[model samples]
Target chain A: MHEMGIALEIHRVCREAVAGRGPGRIEKVRVAVGELSAIEPDLLRFAWEAVTRETTDEGAALEIEWHRTEQVCPSCGPVPDRAPGTWLRLCPSCGGPLELRGGTELEVLDLVFAAEDDPPGPGGDEPGEESA
Target chain B: MSSDERDGRRVTRDFVRIRKSALAANDRVAGELRDRFRDAGTLVLNLVSAPGSGKTTLLEQTVRRLRDELSLGVLEGDVATELDAERIRALGVPARQIVTGGACHLESRIVRRALEEAEFPPLDILFIENVGNLVCPTSYDLGEDFKVALVSVPEGDDKPFKYPGIFRRALIAVVTKVDLLPHFSFDLDRVRERVATLNPAARFVAVSSTTGEGVDAWCDLLREALAAKREGRPWP
Candidate 1:
């Protein structure tokens, strides 16, 4: 759905970030996708491939790190029975209201780029030899 | 150069840590719009729901009852056509239609342009009727003081469980078409219970546009929200 829009935004941000650093090809892009972000990581990756097909960062790998939201109860502290995907309105042990924490995040964590200046080493160079 | 020379060179790889939100630009614009609403003392509300959920119908009724008490404006969002905006304008209220073309959600940039194009006068309330969608719209912020999710009786009570994203983020859940409760097998209590599980802090109001059954209560809640915004108090 809107994964295309998200992929475009990611490309724009990554391009800007890479532009400021120097000339390099992006090797990997790490992103944090929260459970509540409403973004499907698989679809986003597909969209990324489509968007970057002809760009300078073509073939760059997109790594998604999933994040989960936690429910914290006032009286019972963190609820233990509530599963990761399931939701609970009240604490099972104390019947207190539960508050949600974390999740709702969609951010670019880091970018790995291969510098252009580093070429193949000279032939017959010893392991301890220094090159200019 | 020999094969060893090619292998001896070290490839430089740089790892840059950013940790920035993907929607940062959109969020920034939304924050600015929030400041503008606060400065003008206008209570902004974003209404979201599926197509044919009677959102425009409920809005029409809401404007009719509250027009004398407060000045109101509306921004209608649709994939195409200005039919909804025309309907609101027929009520003599300032209304602007934002044709999103193919976008499923209303972003802050387009909303800013639409607000400017509408040339809205000083008003007590401004309602942004988001594109009839429940999923994509939940992720975008339109600088609204609160978000209201509306579902009709025929849409079934399991909507809260099936599409928890909107219910979790919305400040209020409105059950529309309650006049047809006898015809439909809608469980009011079950819907309320499920929505409560998703969002414990959300408020629910059941209304029927045809019979005006719960419109007064909905209006009262809106009035309270307006008062809270004007007084800079935390919303109830």
Candidate 2:
């Protein structure tokens, strides 16, 4: 349900990115979502569809690159045999606190967009709408 | 990563790299609020839990114990109703009720607005009782110094396993309504172990707001967090 808002923010970010780049409809957005990000990929994709409906960016794709957290003990490198999405309190070998690396990401890596109809001469942008 | 010509005039498909967070806007607002709270020397706490996790009850108990010792305020977040805010105000604490209406979770903007409306004195701590849901609330940081995950005894022991996202992100996982522990088969030790595995640094508290059991520990947690905040020490 809250993914709707996230989708809206993604749209905003994408459009802003496109505006800076050129006038083109967004075709696809590649995102990295981690396990601990508090997001469900399916729900986010569904929300993207709902939010992009009837807009110029309609049918835009939301490509999610899933990221998993790794448990690394300060004393003992990476803890092996632990299940994904579960944390280990202490290092099995060293009894030291384990620090998690990655798995909290919610980043937009890149986007693939197709050029729109009008290509403004050399600047790739309209005259009055130009950003100085 | 593939493209073709559209109309021979412009490149049909192009790729642009945008390395940024999807939650940048929300995180920015939360960060600003955090700075403001820090400048005011106030400790902010965000309480997350399921619908019947006794957040408001625990708050009532908190106010009763700490009102005389420290300045306190509450920003009550609910889908609808002034009920929780009224409960806190009835205890003589300055309370702001944020009626989220149909929104499942509270956002940072609303928290800022509620705090602005509060215009309270420099509070030792401000409790933002998030809407009764464990999932969505965890996504948004309310500039809280501590994220408290409340799980009631009736909710059972597997809550940490079921919603590991919240438990893993929380600074503390509190098992509420422990006075009814005799009636339920919920094992506290197992739950603690699970939380430890998920969040090694998370502190666990068994609280029964009804019987005022374990509230001393609860207050001690609060005081510790408050002290850390005021003294500029990093808290666990």
Candidate 3:
């Protein structure tokens, strides 16, 4: 529901980050969604479309990297791999109480854009626009 | 609003990869707000809970108890109304009411403005009474040194478990309206256990403004937090 606000933030940051790049369109953006961030990836994706419709990054892909919360078992130290959204309170091996360590992050990691290798000036060759 | 279905019912529009996080700018501002609060030598506490959690009442009681010893100000957030501010002003404390228009949560910008507008000389404590929403307010950081979550007895014991994020982020968890313990069938143990699971190091206090049961201890804890902030010590 609040994805619209998030989408606007993403747009603002991406625009600022690539503002100096030569005339080129953004191809993809990579964002990491932490397990405890309380964001629905699907909703965010939809919101992104609505926000970027007429922007420079129109039709840009949003690649989400899902981050799972890390649980630390008193006995085992760090649980290697656990299913997302599944709550595990005890260490499977020694039956020790597990502690939640991380995974509350909601941050944009990086953006990938197809910037012009050469300056888009008088001598530059025009590249045909392509859409997927 | 339904993206999955589109026969005049919904439409699914494909978006290109612009993979950016939507909260980058907000995070930056929030970071600055946090630094400002840390430098002010003030313990900013954001109080959050359900609608009738008695947050304003607790603040009124606290102001009456510690006004002489502490310089205090309050930032009250509601959809609309300066009534809470008036109530705090009646207690002779500097207070500002932040009408959030229709915002469900209080963000850093609003608190920053409230701080600028509030004229409290060298204050030791500032309490931000957040909008009475448990879910939306949990995600925002209003430049507070600590988050105090209130869970009244009538709201039931399962609230902590139901909204774990709020309880999880709180530095202090207070169970208010304990005067109704005789009338309500709340399992105290269950509430404590659930809150502990989400926030292992959180401090708990039970208080009733009407009966004055735990008011002293609650105010003492706040004073201790304020003292720790002034001395550059870690908060409890």
* Candidates 1 onward: DockQ, in order: 0.45, 0.38, 0.17
The digit string of per-residue lDDT tens for model 1 on B1-236 reads 01122244544567777888888788899999999999999999999999999999999999999998899999999999999999999998999999999899999999999999889999899999999998888888999998999999999998887777788888889999999999989999999988887788888999999999999999999999999988889877
Candidate 3, residue B125: Cα displacement in angstroms equals 0.3
**Which number leads on DockQ?**
1
* Model 2 clashing residue pairs (backbone): none
Candidate 3: regions farther than 4 A off: A78-96, A116-132, B1-22
Chain B vs. true chain B: TM-score per candidate: 0.95, 0.96, 0.89
How large an RMSD does model 2 have?
4.4
Clashes of 2: 0
Docking class of 2: acceptable
lDDT assessment of candidate 2? 0.88
Can you give the TM-score per candidate against the true fold? 0.91, 0.91, 0.83
When sorted by lDDT, best at the front, the candidate numbers are 2, 1, 3
Give the poorly placed runs of model 1, Cα more than 4 Å off: A81-85, A118-132, B1-10
Candidate with more favorable, higher TM-score: 1 or 3: 1
Candidate 1 docking DockQ: 0.45
Cα-based lDDT at residue B141, candidate 2: 85
**Tens-digit lDDT track for model 2 on B59-165?**
99999999999999999999999999999999999999999989989889889989889888889899999999988887898899979999999999989978877
Better of 2 and 3 by lDDT: 2
| Best-performing candidate as measured by lDDT | 2
